[model samples]
Target: MQKTRPILAWETLLDIARTDAPAPLRERVEHALRRAIDDGHLVPGSALPPSRTLAENLGVSRWVITEAYGQLVAEGVLDARAGSVTRVAAPTLSERMPPPHPPSDHPAPTATPVDARFDLRPGLPDLRATPRARWGSAVKAALSSIADRDLAAAHPGGYAPARQAVSDYLGRSRHVATTADRVVITHGASDGMSILARELRRQGHRAILVEDPSWPRLRDIAQTHGLRTIPIPVDDDGIDVEALAAASVRTGARVALLTPAHQFPVGAALSPARREQVIAWAHAVDGLIIEDDYDAEFRYDRRPIAALQRLAPDRVALIGSLSKSVSPALGLGWMVLPHGLNPEHSPAMPSLIDQAALAHFLVRGDLERHLRAARSRFRRRRAALLDALRAELPDASISGIAAGMHLLLELPAGADAAELARRGRDHGLALTPLRRYEDVSRRPEALVLGYGNLDDTLVSAATAALATLLRARSETPVASVRSERTLTG
Candidate 1:
């Protein structure tokens, strides 16, 4: 007896293909299909539509659909036979291993929300302000400028024009004196760090120095590459250079990863003196400094601090990305390496098409124009957020607003930030506690408020709701304890 094929709905498949994803259309479609199968949205026996039908429904070409299906089939995630249905393969076909699960005693924590009215989580940019039209124009121009052969693959280092464009942008904007040969195009700052960590490990480095209360992912990334991390505390003037030097010498940690331009979450620019001291420390230990220059462009006050690489380009690997300046959806970033580090040793480079488009975006001044407009809008949003917080929560202390998309809000003593964040969730408001960023040690209760993606209305509403919650909680809290350490915001 013949069995019937389980038809997959085109709409269902399209739902997973996010429009904001930086991947190309074909890649996005393929990724959605793989995700669907992995998540059981499409079972092993489920059959995808023919290429022509899916293309017609998606408004893409038959070739695109065919390519996506072909790639999946090659990857063993799907199975296709001549004159038959293309069905999701059995789990056995996919050799990919599931990610290692955390121990039962220590569960992994997720910050994503199911259905929230206001999401004030950190590390996201203003998606509404993304320059869609300008980016499309840049991509079109890039396509016109590239030869057919260029579509095959880019050089391991990067596409030449894009590298040159990135180098020029760094020199012009960040005051980093670098040539194209020193620039390595990467997927993003994370990928560049992973590469650097692996290289450090290969070079017999045992440990890396990172900031305490930093993005948890940084430590995870370092550990994933078989390197131990030594968390150095940060203060208002940025990383405690004296402690960093001490930690480096004591632990023999030769690699230090820092966000000196505008420190993540805390938003403290490294003081001029501290910058010099840090460089001298790097020289003293014969170490490497990985500077993450994310979000250095949108400084509302005065000119943004120059890249630390400007001072000691020979000892710093400067990483920056359009993820903050342009849009995170466009996962394009670059690294300017010191003279000694091998530029040809990148783990993976971005696609030629993306690199070319970013090159055009930079060369045509589209990035500069977009930054100017985005800065104006973000400045207004930041002001609105600060105003709302001040008016609604008079007793609440706020800091870390000098730059970046997030700020730190301190509740009165004896208030539980986690409980407050939970109360916020009840009101359909998503929030994160500053405690989440502390990997090695515990800090005082504080909330990290991200204002970049929130409009004035949402920010006001969310902050007001939080204020009410905090007022109720503060009224009943009587227990108090003294804290010995304070993380500078």
Candidate 2:
């Protein structure tokens, strides 16, 4: 006796097919059907509509439907016995394997705590403020204006118009001296640093000088490329050029990495004297300086210091990115290469479409207008966080607030910053201890509080929670605190 077949719901399949896909029409149909089956919208023993019927429904050629069905059948995702209606096949042997479990001693990794109330992790912008409508308009303008030939292949350095836009923006804003010809677009500052590190290694440089308590990632990048990193202490006047020079002499290291505009983790502008000293040191050693202009766009105290590259363009390689001023997710950055120092290998570039869109955005003056509004918003958020912190913990030393999204908070002596950070996680407040960025022996008993992502409304509550924890720590008996530290350390 023949049995009735279960009819598949064509609406689900039709919706999936109509959605945008990056592949050919036939491949899109195949992927859509597979997704429907995997998602349980189409179960095993369900019969698909005939190719002619589905093609008519989808407004595609019958050949497309047939090809999709044929491919799925070949892959064992669909069953099409000569005269039988096509149906989802049983789970393949490869798909039947059980999920692997972690070792009993090691637990599976977890994401950000579900209970997190405030995120204070630094190096993030206010994602809520992204200019979606303006960006969409820029993208549309870019698509309409771009030549067809420009899309066929991208220049390794960057899309020409995008590079020009960046060059002009830098000149006007940061006072960086460079032309589009010398600009190399990159995925972001990290990618630009990696490229420079590799090129430095290739150029027979064995050692590189880095700030002692700098962003750990920069040192890691140099070390990864086989360059020994000599730690140079950074004081209130930015990187210690005298110490850096001494280190260079001792180690024969000729390359240095600096965040001259506003130092990371610790905000200190390179003083006029130190700037001269650094440039002189570079000239004396015939060395190179890699300047990371990470957050030079949002200075509140006064006009931002001019790019160090502008002082001696031939001696410095300046790297800047949109991560701080704009959203990091854009993954767009530029490197103003020193004259006669182009890398043999080009660093990875961002999407050509993104490059075109940015060019349009810049040319239309949308970026400048957006930044004016962002500065006002971030300024208010920063002030709120600072006011809350001051009210909660008057004795705690807070600095590095002159610019950038984060500030350095130095707790009173004997406070365990690491322990506070750990406890913060439990209390639904995410915190980062200064120790995370420094060497193990260097303990500043400080925390880097990022106010960028923290909502203005949560400032008072989050600060109060942090103060309560600190007060609790202060109340513990000295002996008990030492014992706890000994056990944890």
Candidate 3:
């Protein structure tokens, strides 16, 4: 038994039609009435007011109302009885329309929160120190100097001046043995690695040696290019070069990817002996090395180590980016390739505006100035973090603090790193479990804590919170139980 819908009165119809008119009054009225019937706004078998009365109520002429009603009648949209009463006709399409979908009881899950208040995310540079004014000036200068030909279609490789600027910068900073022609600009270090992997695959190489417990994304890039990754273990003195050689020989891997200068989260500069041995292995196997010179500029303890590419120019491709030194948002990186090795695979180049701006930035020595100031600032932050960590976790053996923005803290044997990370999150802190970097079970349980971006107050607070959680959960040796009560209270 269906309940009857009330008749749509003339005033109600006029009220519905009073929405902003699309254009002329005639077209507006006609379309509005027809739409109302079609959409069941004026329901089937409902009475419509007489034209004269409807027009009078709507403030439109009677002819307008009559014309609209006559049009609907001709279209079989309305039924006009002999008594001169117009009623809405039964809807043909509306009757066949699908029912509205019911709303779901469960909504989509929200994205994971990235902005942890005490975020200690490793590998993130101090973005707050980016020289914005200098960058803007460089961009302006670059725009003013950009030639008409630069706006025309250029090679997908990259702008020559930008590439040259990068080449000169690398030669001066990393001591990479290369020229402007050999430098290929990329969006960033990751993109540069991907491009190199693709080229290696093109050359029929299937396997490449990677440092175990290295940046996971580096292995991902190689694997994504269809290359099998052979994990070479990394020790306190950087990658074990002998193990690397043995693994490469066994796996028939002709390419090795390494971070020789300030080895990632571990912060080990490859021992001179191991660096020489790895280069020898590359020569022995006719292999090539890809040196990721990421974060070489932020060395705190002593003079920065020279790049491995400097020693083996013909057998190494050095990749570096401004992301770590300047800011990650500046997506600019370069690869200084070995001579005679043509990376013919063209990558989609970055914006000409960005390229030109970076070129000007490099040439103007703004990068050096910023790095000088940033190094001092980072050094202070690094010292603060170390002091706090020492004060909090006396028994913990923290390594990799000699260089880079992060340090690896080795927890007590049998302690749960993953669980500690979970507890850290409970206190609004973010921790990177060391196990995440290794695909194998060689490395011990540890946490890679980055003090790069956080200020002194943030560093102290975050470390203190982490220390409290660790003390509550584990019996790991801490500096003193006295600070624990202070932190918790």
Candidate 4:
């Protein structure tokens, strides 16, 4: 059966109306009506009053009523039948926001062990070799000492002691300038980025500049704040600062997001000259820089490079996490903000209850012990990868291997790294394409191989698998004949 109700003409007209109602009353009613409609408080086909009579009922003028109602008709929210008789229009389904994509139900599952398969998933620390036994002891110790009220609810920022520890650690390791007061505990780097993005938006800066071939999760976090995202290109030295300056000037980019320590997946450390140029450019442009120090603790070659934050703390926001050092299970992350750009919530940024109860257990005691073990394990895995890669594919060169758990193998010219990645999976191996990081149309040939979770035996197998790929590509006369080159030694 069809149903009908009264008109919204008068109601909507009052909204956009140049009403004679007091300005305050006009705004209050307008907001209330809009919110009611949005929240489903005012359903479709709801009634409105007669113009002259309702104006009198509300102690208002007919002119006010006419103007308000006229607006509703103009907006198509009301349908006029005869003179002065109007009805509410049927609601449109498009008025509501679309539902979100479903959450990935699980981690992209890794297949069971296959002979000689090298696993190169990015950003994973070798947990199997982490000193789990020691971590267990720390967990037990932390649990035994915890007070009853500690578990009820935490300080919205984070545990104070953990903040103190992180402050101390960052000072020593990342070259960040801060005290415990400057530290805010967070779920991880992702959480801190979200909070910073929102706070930046509040400060009247909305867009973020990210590396085209950078971490994907950052795109999601920046977008959450209704901020626009811009992609900056990267070359051997790091983000093309000149190009970034051009983008900023052209687009009025207010902030630049950087993973300058060692770029994600690509593993190229930002050169000293480029780092200084970036800092200077940001200052000259009055732009804020976000420095993500993802894997600074595990560089196997040379004394560690100084973090970009240390060079310019006033303009730089530093983010680091325990997932790559201690355990992802903890989900613990921290940040160092320039004294005054401080976050109101410690690490609570965009998430409520970001981690499970067990996270605190990893923080209070096991952290120091786990970091020591993780550093050692990644060092071995990094070295083993380089050694095996050289022996197996002596001709298949690698980059970004001087530091971090992953390295990039620039494929022979004209080969599609993205397709090769899929091919690796087909052969019961897991690998990633360098193209995933590229933001623009690129035809480069490279693959990012992570060795964090792979064992020495599997490392050998994976290297052999990759070597076969290189050999087969070389055999094809149509494939562009280019020498296998190591971009990062």
Maximum-TM-score candidate: 2
* lDDT tens per residue, model 4, 1-489: 114435353444333334555574434444444555566555566566676765676576777666666766677665556653455556667755454643676655644233425667777777676656665665565566556676675566565555666676667766778887777777789888888998988888868888878888887789988778888887667888988898898888868999887888667778888899999988998888998887877766665777798888888988888778766876668788885696567433422233322344344545556666666777787777778876865655566747778877777766777667667765656777877766673736777787777776677777777667656655653234343444442
Model 2 accuracy (lDDT, Cα): 0.82
Worst 10 residues of 2 by lDDT: 480-489
lDDT of 3 by residue, 1-489 (tens): 113653755655544345564566666777778777666678777778888888887788998888888888888878786755688876678666865753666764533236778878788887777899999999999889989887886755688899899888888887878888888889888988888898899899998898888898888999999999998888778898888878877889989999988777666778888889989998998999999997888777776767899999999998888888888888988888897677764547878888999999999999999998988888888778878887878667777736678888776666678888877777887888888888774676788888777766788888889888877875645432222110000
- The top-ranked prediction according to lDDT is 2
Model 3 ranges with Cα > 4 A deviation: 1-112, 475-489
**Model 1 stretches with alpha carbons more than 4 Å out:** 1-111, 343-347, 476-489
Whose lDDT is higher: candidate 1's or candidate 2's? 2
Query: Candidate 1, residues 256-340: lDDT per residue as tens digits?
Result: 9899887876667788889999999888888899998968887887777678998898899988888777777788888888987
Across residues 25-113, which tens digit of lDDT does each residue of candidate 2 receive? Answer: 98888878877887789977778888999999888999999999999988888888877788877786667776676557678664445
| TM-score of decoy 3 | 0.76
TM-score for predicted model 4 compared with the true structure: 0.69
Residue-level error in angstroms, candidate 1, position 457: 2.3
lDDT of 1 at 417: 85
TM-score for each predicted model, relative to the true structure:
0.77, 0.79, 0.76, 0.69
lDDT of 3 at 308: 91
lDDT of 4: 0.69
lDDT of 2 at 121: 80
